[model samples]
Target: MERLFGLDMQLIADTLLTAISVFVLFTLASYLFFDTVRDVLKKRQDRIKSDLDTASKEKSDALCYKAEYESKLRDADKEVEEILSAARKKALQNESKIIDEAKEEAARIIARANGEIELEKKRARDEMKKEMIQIATLMAGKVVAASIDEKAQNLLIEETLNEMGDETWLS
Candidate 1:
């Protein structure tokens, strides 16, 4: 037993042997399992990176789709406005056409009424002229047959009007 620095030689030898054993064990574990752990970590990192890329692509696609949808919505709105405007214009045209037709119909009706009025007036005048001619013929025959002074002529005219009656003159 050598005792230098108040430590036993046997204890020092045992401690050194334990340290070497631990070092050897650690070295063997590193050699066997380090590559597998590194490979697993690398695969995990690759998977995470791939997932991130896929997520980013999906996000970009979603943004594009959103933009396209918005554009389409705006186009649809514009189309609707155009359709509405066209409809309004058509409606106004129809209104104007209807008004014009109504005006023309009114004018035709007024013209027809005026023509009928003129025809009625002409007919009434012709009837009056016929009645007047018959009355004049009767008076002439009476005058030629009788030698009439003013008083007799007046009496004859009065008699003739009485015979004709009020109803004849009114008609």
Candidate 2:
């Protein structure tokens, strides 16, 4: 086994110290590795704690934003309701005003029409009265033209009265 790599016993004896030095270096490297791993573990634990705190703060912020949004929505809803109520009231007022104005205008038109009808009736009565008066005057002149005597006028008046019925003439 010693002569397998063609090394002499003298070389082996010379390399014994080198082998011990190499083993010592290996042991020291192993110790350093463990210490570095311990430090990395501690840093990783701290980083995880910080990340957890940040996540918690973000969650709290999200809850706060949600509450604020809900509050704003409620306020907006109230404002909208108030505005709708006011608009409805205004609309009702306008409708009443329009109805009242229309009623007044219709009443005025009806009154004017009634007045025109009364005026037309009165004018027609006056025209009929004028025509009846002219016919009565002409008939009286023709009857009195033959005899201007009082006895002839009395006889004519008696004959005209005899021809009239009580239903056709008031008197």
Candidate 3:
């Protein structure tokens, strides 16, 4: 029934009542749903933290495995080098032994050849002595059978030397 500043008093009272009803509904909704929303957000945050922790642990384990593999590879390389070095040393020793044996065999062969040459020289000298003795006996028989003057004796000696030949004296 009354009007203030050209607005009805009944309309103002109705707007105030509607605003109070909206505020009461909003408060009730917050009281009922706030705990559920907070719990869901907390659970999501905990799951993300757990996933990050697992990833970090796995990365650390992979790094440790890489280091162990590298160490084993280095040890294998060292063992291979040692085996190659030992093989080279053994090959050198075998070469030296073979060379020494060859030298010893060569020395023995040279010594045997020299001994045979000496034996051949001795046999040649003995044969020459026997030929000379037979020639001297023939010369004595000729001298006793005929009496000769100095000129005839010289002729006989010259003929005996010519019959002996040059090769017999040269040897």
Residue pairs with backbone overlap in model 1: none
TM-score of 1: 0.61
What does candidate 1's lDDT look like per residue over 1-171, in tens digits? 665666778989999999999999888888888888989999999999999999999999999999999999999999999999999999999999999999999999999999998887778767865776677567756775676676776677677767766666554
How far residue 32's Cα lies from its native spot in candidate 1, in Å, is 3.5
> How much lDDT does each candidate structure score?
0.85, 0.81, 0.81
Give me the overall lDDT of model 2.
Answer: 0.81
Best by lDDT: 1
Q: Scored by Cα lDDT, where does model 1 land? A: 0.85
- Assess candidate 2 and give its TM-score to the true structure: 0.61
Work out the TM-score per prediction: 0.61, 0.61, 0.49
* Candidate 2: stretches off by over 4 Å: 1-27, 30-43, 137-171
Query: Per-prediction RMSD in angstroms?
Result: 6.7, 6.3, 7.3
| Top candidate by TM-score | 1
lDDT of 2 by residue, 1-171 (tens): 465677778889879978998999888987988789889999999999999999999999999999999999999999999999999999999999999999999999999999998888777767655655565566568778865687776666566546543333321
Q: What is the C-alpha local distance difference test score of candidate 3? A: 0.81
> On residues 1-171, what C-alpha lDDT tens digit does candidate 3 reach at each position?
565556568879888888888888877777778777878889989989999999999999999999998999999999999999999999999999999999998999888989988878778867776777677557756875787765776677677777876667557
Local error of candidate 1 at 94, Å?
1.3
Which residue pairs in model 2 clash with each other? none
